[model samples]
Target: MKIVITGGAGFIGSNLARALTEQPRVTQIRVLDNLSTGHKPNIAGLDVDFFEGDIQNAVLLDQVLRDADAVVHLAALPSVPRSLRDPLASHHANTTGTLQVLDAARRAGDLYVIAASSSSVYGANPNLPKHEDLTPAPMSPYAATKLATEAYLSAYHHSFGLPVLSFRLFNVYGPGQRADHAYAAVIPKWVSATLAGQPVTVHGDGTQTRDFTYVGTVCRVFTNALLRRIIEPRPVNLAFGTRKSLLDLIPEIEVATGRPAHREHRVPRVGDVSHSQADSTRLLALFPEVTPVPINEGIAATVDWFRASAVIAASS
Candidate 1:
């Protein structure tokens, strides 16, 4: 099978690329990324065709989508804080870029699309175990764009008969992810800080909970979504089915790193939700083989990678 992974150099995309390389049925894996937020080192030493260009580029999308059996769309400016800071950039990448990919896929003749959505689309609905039936009340520009893109995918599936699936991934974390970015996810940031004996910053009392799904698990879902033939585009929650608060996360990090987290509390940023949890019943029904790694185990693995990378950097 010929597959194209958009944003294939980013954290989730890189991990997905690595996982897909192990599949015997996958004959060719092509990665399309602009390296704006993606790292070239992530896909280094991997056997795949790499294209460095913007997803918004029509020529680039056309070139990459050609002859592709499925396209795993993971490209986007994926930070709520960053989106709040600059909505236009987020809209251009998340919404416009998604439209371009869908258009390309529509023209590519029966090309399957497994696109990445986000849990942030739920916003602050005060609902537990967020399900697909709930109305999306997006609080941030990022979430809004993701919601809009999902609508687009639905429309394409209904009108154009495109086989598309959008997985609303929760907080995904694993190796090849750095905490140095201004908009880094909580796990990496806390892990890095705890390892370095620095105070881990907690926004809004550290009570913000998330369904932090392991990247490996998410990759498996991507594989399933790609291989399956869907009649229409549908949004499914891809998560570990477990939720943890930031406060609950600190001690786990401390245990893994053998160091206490010097937590520094600050006012919560705008567009941030207080809590989020996903009910991935639909996802599990589709792929019963997916077994999400426990949060502690996942954290330990992530810390190991961060420590190893730090050691390598220090040695250099």
Candidate 2:
């Protein structure tokens, strides 16, 4: 099987690339990234082809899609805070970029395109255990773009017979996540600050909750989705099927590093949701073996990686 992963140097993509290398049926794995936000070090020394280009480039997208049996579309400007900074940049990467990849897949052949959606698509809906049947009410341009992509996916599937599956990933955390960026995910930012012996910043009083799933578990879902010939009646949620508030997370980090989190509370950023918990019933139907590591266990492993590799921790 030939696979092409966009943003292959990013946190999820790099790890997916390395894991795919071990699969016996995989003939070649190509990474198409512009390196705007993705790191080169993530894919260094890996046995994979790396194509550094924008996904919006029609020729390059077509070239890569031609021979690919499947595409893992992971490239995007994926942050609510960052999207608020420049909505136009976010739209191009998240929406237009995704459309381009879908188009390329259509032109090349009938290939399975597994798009990387986000939990933010659920928006500010107060309902717990978000299910796919709920109408999406996106709060920000970032969330809006993801929702739009999901809608577009169904159109492609119905009209062109493209086998597209959307995985709305919750707060995915493990290694290689960027810290110190204008839009850092809460886990990496907290980890970076606590590891540096600095006070961790808590926006909105540390009450926000998320279903933080490990990256490895998410990767396994992608591989499982590829192997299955039929996917079902709804888009799937890839999460731990549970929730933990930021208040709940702080203690876990404290235990991981053996230091208390000195937290500083501030007003919550605009477009940040109060909570997100996904129902992974659909995810399990596709891959029953995909059990998530406990949130604390995932956090402990992430902290150990940051602590053991000074360069990785410092670079981010």
**Cα RMSD (angstroms) for every candidate in the order listed:** 1.1, 1.7
**Per-residue C-alpha lDDT of model 2 across residues 207-270, encoded as one tens digit per residue:** 7888999988888878777666444425789996679999989999999989878999998989
Residues 80-102, candidate 1: write the lDDT tens digits: 98998899999999999999999
- Candidate 2: clashing residue pairs, number: 0
Between which residue pairs do clashes occur in model 2? none
TM-score of each: 0.98, 0.96
Tell me model 2's lDDT, rounded to 2 decimals. Answer: 0.86
Off by over 4 Å in 2: 229-233, 311-316
Candidate with top lDDT is 1
CA lDDT, every model vs. true structure: 0.89, 0.86
Candidate 1 weakest lDDT stretch, 10 residues: 224-233
Cα error, residue 246 of model 1, in Å, equals: 0.8
In TM-score terms, which candidate is top?
1
Residue 225, model 2: lDDT of 73
